[model samples]
Target: MNWPPVPQVDLLEGLHLRYGVLATELRLLSDGLDEAARTFRVGVGNGPDLALRLAAGDPRPVTYFVLLHLRDRGVDAVVAPLPTMTGEAFVRVDGLTWSLYPFFDGADGWTHGMDVQAWHNLGSALRAVHDVPPADAVVPREAFDVTRYDGLTAWNAASR
Candidate 1:
């Protein structure tokens, strides 16, 4: 809660004005000091629930584009962020990046118990994501040099 703090009513109102979503309830779904993002289950009146996330210092715009691409590529497992009235993927509110996604029911593979079909579906999804051409600017590239990793350097020195 301390990381980004709970969103105020005005913020939600702004969300509605910008995205045309009428958020009726905002229930916190993630709670921890170490969490990277504060997630909430948003209840929309007369519509499917949406998941709201507030994260700081994340490259959300690129991520949103990639997710949108993945969904377009027939990856049903991934949920694309809802675009604003201006067609922007994410909005900045009080120094935190806020994005909304269609909340899908069902737990992750770990919790829901992945069967054979589930594994196959997961593999297909991974293939679809990985198959995205690198030419696309939205695809994230390696941000750091692996040779500079302290743990890897230590392991290499110990092995020598």
Candidate 2:
């Protein structure tokens, strides 16, 4: 897929300074058209193929907290963004949020298969994520509490 061009120098420098991994090569793994974020496979100096994503939005602290909590709970399936040197999950560069992910090249897209098992597996994964209770003090209860506006519905009904 044709990904929107990455801000190469800015992103590379951010990753380098934060992670201490000087990546000599960067390749576009996928475009944001399907995932809403561009994924990049970075070839660091004799290390694993690290994955990084550039997302066009503010870094959601609560979401990252939940991810870390899930990881702590032994749900290895949940791909949490790796924290930077100062422990921030995302780095803001050129108005975009760049976050690091462990490269899982085996991940298949939602459209990969059109079968019952695939659909069931997708549903099960979603259910697993929904079922995980937010960790205490990881993401505050206030972050989950939402008051409805004129037309916007707060999705965190269970948290209330």
Candidate 3:
């Protein structure tokens, strides 16, 4: 019996990192990383790192970039500081980047009304994530070996 199986990922060539990158980028941007510095392979996640996977390589570095963006922001809302790269980021441990934050107790999983408090919270989080500012950090595009992070797709299992 196989103790561990190969990763289940995008079959279409050049699309493997699409979803993960996009999702990670959104989460980072949403957490406020508009001009944040990015570092690939900063650490690992529950599964294979995204950037590396997309490059048809190893640990995706871009995922760590997103995590680093979030972590640099000073908001520990999600996970603790992502596992360091040991070389660049410096990690004495081996694990995921973000410290898995506890599940938020939303009013409902199916749906939530646009109440005043909800609106306030939404605005607050949005503001926090979207409020961009000037910074010395810059991630050269040439550094990332994959396409820029973008797009979101609804998953469908039937095709598989």
Q: Between the candidate structures 1 and 3, which one is better when assessed by lDDT? A: 1
Tens digit of per-residue lDDT, candidate 1, span 1-160 = 4575554696579768878887888888743353667777888888899887778775556768888877777777788988888898888877778888888766776556888998998898788778766436775577787656769878999999
Clashes of 1: 0
Ranking of models by lDDT: 1, 2, 3
Give the top-scoring candidate (TM-score).
1
- Estimate, for each residue in 76-119, the C-alpha lDDT of model 3 and write its tens digit: 44232323223233211123222222223235422545768777
The weakest ten consecutive residues by lDDT in model 1 span 30-39
Quick one: ranking by TM-score, best first? 1, 2, 3
Error of 1 at 148 (Å): 21
Weakest lDDT window of 10 consecutive positions for candidate 2: 145-154
TM-score of 2: 0.68
Q: In model 2, which regions exceed 4 Å deviation?
A: 1-7, 31-36, 107-109, 114-131, 138-160
The clash count for each model shown is 0, 0, 8
RMSD in Å for all candidates:
6.6, 8.4, 17.9
